[model samples]
Target chain A: MGTELVGGRTVLGTLRSDPPLTLRQTGHGTVHLVSTAAGPLGGDRLELAVDVAPHTTLEIASVASTLVLPGNGESLTVVEARVGAGATLRYAPEPTVLAAGCAHRMVVRLVLEEGASVSWREEIVFGRYGERPGTCHSRFDATIGGVPLLRQEFVVGDPAVDGSPAVYGDARCVGSVLLAGPAFGHPGPGNGGRPGNPRGHASVIAEGCAVLPLAGPGTLVSALAPDAATLRARLTWGLGRS
Target chain B: MDAALLLLADSRLPAGGHGHSGGAEEAVRTGAITGPEDLARFLRGRLTTAGLVAAALAAAACELATAPGAAADQAGTRPDEPAAGAAPESAWRELDAEADARTASPAQRNAARTQGRLLLRSARRIWPSPALDTLAGAVPDGAHHPIALGAVSAAAGCSPHDAALAAAYTSITGPATAAVRLLGLDPVVVHRVLAGLVPDLTSVARTAGARAAWERLPAHAAPALDLLAEQHLRTEVRLFVS
Candidate 1:
């Protein structure tokens, strides 16, 4: 379905973190987020909209795994984000877990002027499905400075499709993120195949990392830190300082 | 089999496709794909899903380009009775928009569009179809592969039938050559393998049904390849994305 914010001011920047949330925003505010609590949610939506005037910092967060339920009624919880120019939007949400048979659709849109910076990440687990063993379709679009910088679409699942060698060769876990603005000036990895380069992908940042392969896993976590240098360097390399 | 199709579809055409492995080299590194058969399977899957999808979209564009007097025919149209001419120019507006929506990764999309532009740069000269000229004029940046290929086919005096043939051959030839590079297969052996595919590709090209004519053209699908790409994005150094 659609997300309805529970509480907030006039600006459409309000946040409610319950099973179903609503966030409204009126005038100047850093952010208005509706975060979900612990435990599994029955496929609820945390809808958020940020109005970052001239110069503003709005950081949004999710309480936990926003447990996305297997889809029977086409279960979904979506976030509709819109960003204005000269605004810094740092949206780092907890990874969404698609419990067995669950399906989800997420749409994020950011409209930035010449100098707005946005670091957004989308990660998913196939759930009890053992490395996400089914079909999933996702579409993402972004327009920065009148240029449509990113647009992604994919469908996972089905024999006719799965049987093909083209789409998915074998990896299970997947993640995608986009970086915009001046700080990303020297796009590091340029094309993402160079040696020792890692810029565009924010997930590699040391703030939270588990370098160990996932064949067998162990818990690894760390609070976010202001020391974004290593991250920045990696980003530069990943983006290929071009 | 026509030798021209082999040249037309070769990824090493300096079309910037060398920058992309269609996720082959990338996926293989991630262990998402392995060995010769795996490569074949992956390539086949891409052709049917992502490849097929791209072809369908391109076919529509060709149909549009072929419209009679398509000043009238611009680009991105269906190969309807271009005898009418007006249909293609208008249809392309929507078709190209749809392609923009379907393609996500900005980098990958850029790769595709860039390839299309270069292909058009060369194809327009090699085959100069009015459809190609008009569509290229209407879309200065060059349309996506399907659109460009469609226009190219139209200009070359081939029907939608020819478009399909060209697409299939282009898709297969690239991988076959790559296989030759990766496995060091003899050119004679590669040619034999390629020869075996001709009948099937030609059949598909010539086989047209009413349903095929009216459908929304299939879309590109290659998640394993994409995820492998994501995996590659994380690599410290790599030979290909997958």
Candidate 2:
């Protein structure tokens, strides 16, 4: 994380990781998050922090899909990020696959200063190869000047999700994209001008909302699909404009 | 079991709740809920996810309203400027924003606001309170339904748990009633389904009441419901507002 910036680059930044949790700087303002272990096993805990200073940008990605295996315990991931004024942070991680009998909890908190911009996506697959989905509890809380831009928590694999038409329905894949600040005037594909009529059934959640403008500050775009490929395509479409 | 809770939860309380089906109308139209069994599952799903979220929010609001100095917090209040001369409860706005963030569908958000407005109108007459006036001033377009319900519950002397129960009970009862109207399902059978869910409903209320922190309140998102609301909004022959 950067405490200051110089010459349009991060002046102070640091990265720390434990086993199976490594950070690799792939390019200028870009980092590839890699895990050495086969994947997240039971009882694993991971923490990450990134700080983008003014006039700098940071992009985060994962090397491959993170596999969540069955375990007697649960795993947790907590990420804290700060996007400074005039800075940008884009986080697009690979999909996470929840295998049967696994329980995982993820919490992400982002603080954005004035003029900061962020474009992030999170994709989840219930299970791979037709297996039943495991349990997952994810919470995202973000703010600007202490005013809430987004506060959301989702639980999967509960009895409520088994056959709820109000939830997943028949889709096994779900994802969300968040675009905030003045930088995203309408980033991706689609006619960002016409109030966005999101359609197309086969791939996206037939009933999922495409793009939604928030009350005070941000925009949230969410989608549901039958598989990762469809979700990825839709996310890419959203990312293009953002 | 409080009388105030019952009154506030009553569908006939002139809240304009009858106009929206809570997504049941669209679900029925799409054949997602073709019979009583399907309707039962739908209600169960909604009760646990969205229902739980609403319950927690109502409970949180009730706590805020019943706190010490809540009344004097309301000073010079007029019809158009309600929040004026009032205690600065930034938490109220944050909770409202949380509701906005949890609601992913534009149609759903509009529906919730409409119902909230109607509830506020009815509450202001039924139970006169400066807190309600302050809320009205704060959110002229209308606060979200759960927020209004919580505030009204407090004005009516209901506990946070009572507010949670009221919120959770209405979350499903409204839709169950909608299903009966839309599909001509036997009211006897629908009531039976609701009866079977009594235990779960009570559990949900208790769980929601136990959570004191607004940020810790549930933020479950139902993609299917979000999609259905969006689809319902676009449908020309829709009978429900959402």
Candidate 3:
């Protein structure tokens, strides 16, 4: 739903959303999504759609943390986006805190054209205060020219499942960074003018998608971390910000 | 059940599986897994997430190989003519990309490709099918492990479901075997943990076989696994490749 501009900058097009979701343009190709309903309530179904034209860039961020309260039914959020050739989208949403008795699922699906690029980040905290976390499932799928580029799914805080070392390894906060496009090449720590940050480990899984993980000090520390602020700061640092 | 599937699932098939621990070595080094209980939990989580993803990819690949016109395309004579369902080369590349997306560590990606290449080498001799040859020609460095497994499974006259079963079983077996060697856990106890997982493995394979399209394949991922794979690569002394 977007087209190329003269300078090859990506501008948002056909931005559509409903209640509890507000949009404010912070800068060119940048918009901040603000929630007005405190947070997603029980049985809430939310959808956000974005279209980035060719030669345009879109940066999206949430105004605050998405706090999931106790709900009678499961809450869901679905995001669908299309990036044209030479377009880019940087999606860095705030941390999501799953409260007790909450069930939430978020699905993000993106379709990219040749030469398109996308950088996305998601942070999840088990609980806000001292309460146990609820069930949460997050899925991400991206395709280029109808071909799959990346696909990932995460399930957290389910009572039926044991705290497997392979899944979370006692980490309460989990953060992920995904960069895909012609612009994002495979760059390790030593190269790319970026010193290696030991706070997180990044790997270029493919030509496009790269993953970074941020956790706490020891096994106990990582598991008992009260919040995601430390992890977020590390993530911001990992993404090359001062 | 196809007898060839047993060969593909065997750890002693000279597929380079023995050299890789599937990140279990790193997990042990970090003290994330110290006993049979922890190992069981780890395997269960891995079986549902990474194992499911691999099973789905293998199933889809097998379906692609056995599709109509696959035999004709295997001749490698028709670079212009598209296959009956999806173009074989593009489809294989797309599947490979999905595999890359699902894997978030450079070490794991390299390990997968290495294993894939080794598997293809053995398959070309044992099965000697045109589909496998064409796939081998397409990705000289090697397709991802699941992609190669599917193609080889089809060549060996196995169904997509059988391929899925093989893929699912191998995902945990590699790491379990590695734990036995690294942690010196009792082999019987280590295998009992695996034996307890038969029902889940069957469920995962069934789910994988249900999906026919590559685009709709499972993307379940454990971020801890990605982290472990990267950490395993940096260790000064390590027993396994990943």
Candidate 4:
């Protein structure tokens, strides 16, 4: 059976995986699900719970992007992504592309409990103009403590505008490059994926256009790419330097 | 009012609106906006996210009448809290505060207020609404464009919602004028683009009123067009102010 557990508040849940990770579905390829029983808040603050046992390595797809939607009710969507001191969570979904007309809000708090390693990505499509249908307006915020950790809000579908003046010139696609880590501590331009650089990097690639890696020192700051080659150079420089 | 729509596009008018391409220049040069479809996309995006700056300001102006102390804030000072008389006025004061807080850009705050002041002066001379007369006397210098537009709209034989329509339309035409100056697209084509885009603005204004009527709040995603605008400000060559 493919199942797992979870937790809340930075994750109040104990996390488990389905199919043991290595055992894939052969045909459909591999799908990894990390379940947790983190306490969720609702009537009485949803206390999230999280539990991740050591020695468990989860295989994840190097997704193109990942997008978080908005809150369901009056409450915000809180997701606690935690990696145990020894446990690793590789979350490389196929760049969870956000469709136009999607206005969501979410809170993603990750707890890398010492020695824990996880690869996470978040991306959004500004649409390829008429080829696409709409835009997305969502907010993503996270914090390790009362201090800020990762706070991002990408609100698409602003009924106010259809396109951005930068890429399209009264055009439609706009990708906000926001990614950060210890590597990009200073407010300098970031390179593309190199490796070992700061492991914290987020990027977005629209169509065949250049893929921009929002690689920086902070989790919320992104270094944008003007073209695909630039994006490649950025990733190469970033990972290479690392 | 359509002439108001036209004047909004006429950067030549001394409204200082010329300084701002309404984000058109930045979006195009930066690659966020391009071409016709891209232009449409850019328009929609601007209207929804960045456009809120104007919409909310317009809405606040429309609601100024009910605010008891609205006159004080309007008197060249930031729109202030309603007077301390009634409970409802106090609620509007809180609403005005939220609107100010949500408008995070200092420059935009200036632009809105600047446009408002001039608009109020012109509108007050042409037509008179008790709301405008009272608020004008209470507020200082050029009131923000929204407050001016909303109040002025009432004075000019229009509704708050109609003011919103005009306010929203202003954002688009400003850029089209830039496109004409920048690209020299045919006169007919420019009008064609306007014709197609106009309905969207009208619809957005109505929807905005409906949404504002409810939560009395609409989405707040003022895309940091200021970044591009800031860059433009530093550039040696630029056609618009913003």
Candidate 5:
């Protein structure tokens, strides 16, 4: 996937679709990920690449929650994105549900150039209703101007560790929103008169959710809840969207 | 392992480590760890995630401190002459920034730096090495705890692997000790839990030490622990600072 700015409007440049994962342009500067196939079943290797050109804005979202089902072996998905200088990328995907007996790995690498900004959100649901989750390893690496911004990986599956208070506690869902760039009060090349609140102070929003301002120009809103609804609600609230 | 490495791992180092519970206090309060078994599970999860990250950082820091020309450069520079220190100073700054990137939570970062500042203070007086002084000059506020530990370990004649071991070991031992204090768990049983974790601890340390590149260090994150660290800070009355 690629985007370019034409006549002060963002336009799609190149979008190559593969099986199971397809991209649809829903509106100007907005794209929705549509899953054409049923399962990213075990042993599947999927990759998605996104590039947003300078001065362009792109918003990518998903149509529905991803269901990871058990299959022959482990499944892997990698999404790599680059936002060029003065560009913006907003990636808000639906929650991924880890079904019982399935093993899935999701890796997202996002690179932002100087003056670029991103609002990336990720959510994970342990399992379907009344079912125990399998294993899911999620890794997110974000870098700005060749420096590390956020590098994190989470593994959820083992009952002992997942249920521990130091991990998931009693929460069946976990989520985080990473807001980085000059738009989020991070010092960059230029703001370009973008409307962004400079108040990036850290604060607790709810019972198990908090907004953490990074040492750099970024903010992370993290939350855990008993269910997907509550998790989304808390994350939304953490982002001040609710 | 060097004997001084044991000193680095000991809880009674006056590095202000006792004031932090590594999220065990929050886990206990949430009833996620109600018994010795639960505590054991929590420690294991932490050892793999946060512990591994810290171990890798410590190992990387130690490797940088002991790299060819680093010692010589540090030896030629005065504590106040950070500009004259050259490569080593920038290297330390980069490692510290990497630590900041790995830590998503402000509260956790604050806790790590607080511990780092105190550890640097004590290490300077005890080991008194040019490398440690260079690190202090590089990061006036503080280096992350793991970075400081690695540099200090080098000054105390410990290898990078030893620094990794110390980091990985302390990550769990501190929480185990806190669990005993917070949940009133049997000290003997907790010790048994720690003893059982030796194999896992060694393996984690080995993996961490094997990686020499600081940019590619382990970045495993425990979401519950991050949330707990933030939530712990908001708690009106809590035993641990983080």
Candidate 6:
């Protein structure tokens, strides 16, 4: 999917879709992902590429939460996005459920131009109801002007690691919202000429949530909760504070 | 194992690592870690996630420090030293930034850099390596702890594998010590827990040292750990700084 600025409004340029990963335009600059089939079942591979042209804005969201189911092998989904100069891209997908006996991997690579900005939000629900969660690996890599801003991967579902106090500590839902670019007015690398301020101050807005300013021009809001609703609420609150 | 590696791994190195719990304090306060069993589980999880990241980074930094032209650049400022080029400086900057990228929580990044700065201060006096000076010049505020450990280890004639081992080992030992102090657990039992993790620790270090590229370092994030770090920062009377 691609977007371009035309006549003072963002318009879709290259809208392509493949089975199980269909794209639907709900409004100008807004696209909703509609999954036609269930189960990114084990062994499934899915990919999505997005391009936001200069001065354009694109917001991509999913209509519902995705459920990962077990199959013959592991499943993979990769999303690569590029935002041009002065462009904005908001990719807010619903929560992902890692069901019992399933294994899944999700990778998102986002690159921004000199003046580009982005808001990327992700939430994960470990297993459904009371069942143990299957393995799910999520990697997000973002860079601006060829300089890395954030590169992280979270691997969950292992009972030993996930249930450890150092990792999950009883939280079942986890999420983060990354807001980057000049729009947020965050201090760039070097923290606006302040030395020794490398650990940008983080504001704890809720019980288990915080909004942290990055060393670069970005802010990350992270939260953990016992339930999906509380997790989303904390993330939303933290985003507002950020 | 080099004696210098053991020295670098010593908890009493005056690196200020004693002030941080590596998220164990927060876990204790939250009732996640009540005894030796919980601490053991937590240490194992941490050894795989944060420990792996630090080990890989230390290995990469050590490799860079021993790179052909790097030694020349570190041989003090000479008129002809410019011929060594900007590679070493740029490489240090990139590695430090990569450390920042991998650390999503501001509190955790701050803690790592704080320990890094202090470690550099002490290592410079003990080892007095030109590489340490080069690293200091590159990242004036401070290099991340793993990077500093790697450079200091190189100055002490240790291999990348040794640096990785020290990095991985400290990731657990520090927290284990903190748990003993905070929870009043039996030191013997905590050491027993650490002993049990020896196999996993070696494997993690081996895996981390095997990675040749800085960009491909392990970035396994533990959301609960990130959350705990942030929360620890907000506690008015916390025992650890992060």
lDDT of 3 by residue, B113-206 (tens): 8899999998899889878877877677788899899998999999989999999999999999999999999999998999999999999999
Docking class of 3: acceptable
RMSD of each: 9.8, 5.5, 6.4, 11.6, 4.7, 3.7
Error of 1 at B202 (Å): 13
lDDT of 2 by residue, A1-242 (tens): 44356665664477666778788878777788898886587788878888888778888999998888766589888889999888888998999898888899989999988678888788889889788878998888877655566777778887655568877777788888988886433332221121122331112233343666554356677778888998888766655543
C-alpha TM-scores of all predictions: 0.60, 0.89, 0.85, 0.52, 0.91, 0.93
Model 2 lDDT at residue A123: 85
lDDT of 3 at A62: 84
Q: Once model 5 is optimally superposed onto the true structure by TM-score, how far is the C-alpha of residue A170 displaced, in angstroms?
A: 1.7
Model 5 chain A worst lDDT window (10 residues): A188-197
- In model 5, the Cα lDDT at residue A239 comes to 89
- The most accurate candidate by DockQ is 6
In TM-score terms, candidate 2 sits at 0.89
Error of 1 at A69 (Å): 1.8
Instruction: Judge candidate 1 at residue A40 and give its lDDT.
Output: 31
Name model 2 segments beyond 4 Å from true: A1-4, A183-209, A238-242, B68-91
- Evaluated against the true structure, the overall lDDT of model 5 is 0.84
Model 1 lDDT per residue over A12-80, tens place:
233444444524332343343343343233344444454554345566555444556553444444455
Interface RMSD of each candidate, angstroms, one decimal: 10.4, 5.5, 7.9, 10.1, 4.0, 1.8
- DockQ preference between candidates 3 and 4, better one: 3
Better of 4 and 5 by DockQ: 5
Q: Per-residue lDDT for A1-242 in model 4, tens only?
A: 12133331122123333321222232222343322222111211222223344434444443133332222322233445554555545444332333333333444555544445445544344433243423443444322212223333455454443334432233233333333333333333222121212433322222222222222223222223333334344433433333
Error of 2 at A13 (Å): 2.7
- What DockQ does predicted model 4 obtain? 0.09
Clash numbers, per candidate: 77, 9, 4, 140, 1, 1
lDDT of 4 at B102: 36
Candidate 3 per-residue C-alpha lDDT over A11-118 given as tens digits, one digit per residue, 9 for 90 to 100:
455655566988877777778898978658779988888887777778889889999876768999898889888777778888889887788999999888867777
To one decimal, what is the Cα RMSD in angstroms of model 5 from the true structure? 4.7
lDDT of 2 at A27: 79
